[model samples]
Target: MKVVETVSGIRETLANMRTAPGKRLKVGFVPTMGYLHEGHQSLLSKAKAECDIVVLSIFVNPLQFGPNEDFDKYPRDSERDLRLAEQSGCDVVFMPSVQEMYPNPIRTSVSVKGVTERLCGASRPGHFDGVAAVVLKLFHIVQPDKAYFGLKDAQQVAVISQMVSDLNVPVDIVPCPILREADGLAMSSRNVYLSAEERREALVLSKALGMAERLAQEEGLTFEALRNKIEGEIRSTPLADIDYIEVLSYPELEPVDPSMETVSRTSDMIVALAVKFGKTRLIDNVILHRK
Candidate 1:
């Protein structure tokens, strides 16, 4: 229930806790924008279970969103987020303002070269750079023993992992499973933009992934064939416009060559898709182990 608005305030509070503590306090941190949802709650619940203290940060990072993107309209409810964080067992809520986090112009950013070149990165230029910079800043600010991120943003997870390893950030980056709605839509704060019809159309992303999974599992289909099928499914939905459909090697995320049978046999594949429903872009993916 305690909300610390300034960065200095958070630092002071944590310092006091560190000095008074008998044992070294293990803190788990979940950094997010201020919209509380079941997906975020899932992360907090896991953090609470594992760590002695849980810190949830609710700052709508302006740097992460492009000029045309929804930075201004991004849903924010600090009061609601605070209550939910408290209910989910978070000890401290860090709600720093834009000015507080970015006092002067930022010069440097963390960027993972290969992984940041495809999927979401391909479409949105400088998106991952912004994500990397803000996340690094948050890690420095919170200085938690462990930090948690949802797997819904698979590429983001990969990028962050790479940054942490390269930079030697002294925290464990724990990736939790993707939380989905009962209807199978991957939970997202941006899901609010979907209207009644667009909402129905949005399911195509997951459905296409399901089709790819079936093909990969049952038909013993090649990566190219499976990717084609996924793309076909998305195109079939009138409201859906395909952005990118790729089956890449897991973790490294390099595009797999299905023509080379040996590559398919040796590699674990991941099918990832990004499609635009009207103006809202949605992403979904499924991982398959080649037999």
Candidate 2:
């Protein structure tokens, strides 16, 4: 596996890789903030299975973090990440510095509407703007045929998909499933910050999601009731500080009123939530399929 830290180096390396004996190479890209784990591995494995070459970009984008957020405190393990990258079928690893990524002051950005009005966007103002901007920059830098993202950040997946569709970017956005820990907690880089007890308590997120999914399967369960039940489940844990619990129409994320109580079995939906355990915040969701 080749690890390139400079933007020019990655572009040059990928450019070289794009040239084969007789066929055009298919490239799959996975953009992440480093601290590789099972979730990231899953993305790389999927990319490898689908493409001729796989590139992994690791840069903890300051743009994605709020002013008060843990940009500085986010975990980093370059040596370990490199080992994991190669093991997970990543061909080239793009680990750029902040200065390398943003050499000049960034005056322009990309944004998606509607999807950004709630959840992480509402809680952390300008968060998705940072995500969209950085993602766009990376997409330009990497220029892969397809990019993979985990559904753990379903809203992010939605926002990026919207950006890609509206901008007509040539890359295909592949949304992968969320990988959870053995016990149930959703995997996240921020999860490392959780204390031993906080980590254990965090299981409520997956448990709540499970219950919500089963409850929502019922033909008459209202979105509001499902959301409230989720909130209550998480609240039952003393350490789980609630951020938001919402049930919305799938990729659209449109809010459905409680009065329209009987959810259509044919309508696809999602129940997503963000809760803080100690200083660490985690997000998890389940997509309800059309019955």
- Candidate 1 residue-wise lDDT at 225: 70
Model 2 lDDT tens row, 1-291: 999989889999999999998999999999999999999999999999999999999999998888899999899999999999999989999999999988898999777899999888899999999999999999999999999999999999999999999999999999999999899888898888988999889998899889977786677776777778888888889998888888888899887776675655568888888888888888899998877
Window of ten residues with lowest summed lDDT in model 1: 258-267
Error of 2 at 146 (Å): 0.6
Candidate 2: clashing pairs of residues:
none
lDDT for position 181 in model 2? 87
TM-score of each: 0.95, 0.98
**lDDT score, candidate 1:** 0.84
Alpha-carbon shift of residue 217 in model 2 (angstroms): 2.4
Compared with the true structure, what per-residue lDDT tens digits does model 1 show for residues 161-243? 99999989999999887777888898888888888999998888877777777676664456667777777878888998888
Model 2 scores worst on lDDT over the 10 consecutive residues at 257-266
Which candidate has the top score in lDDT? Answer: 2
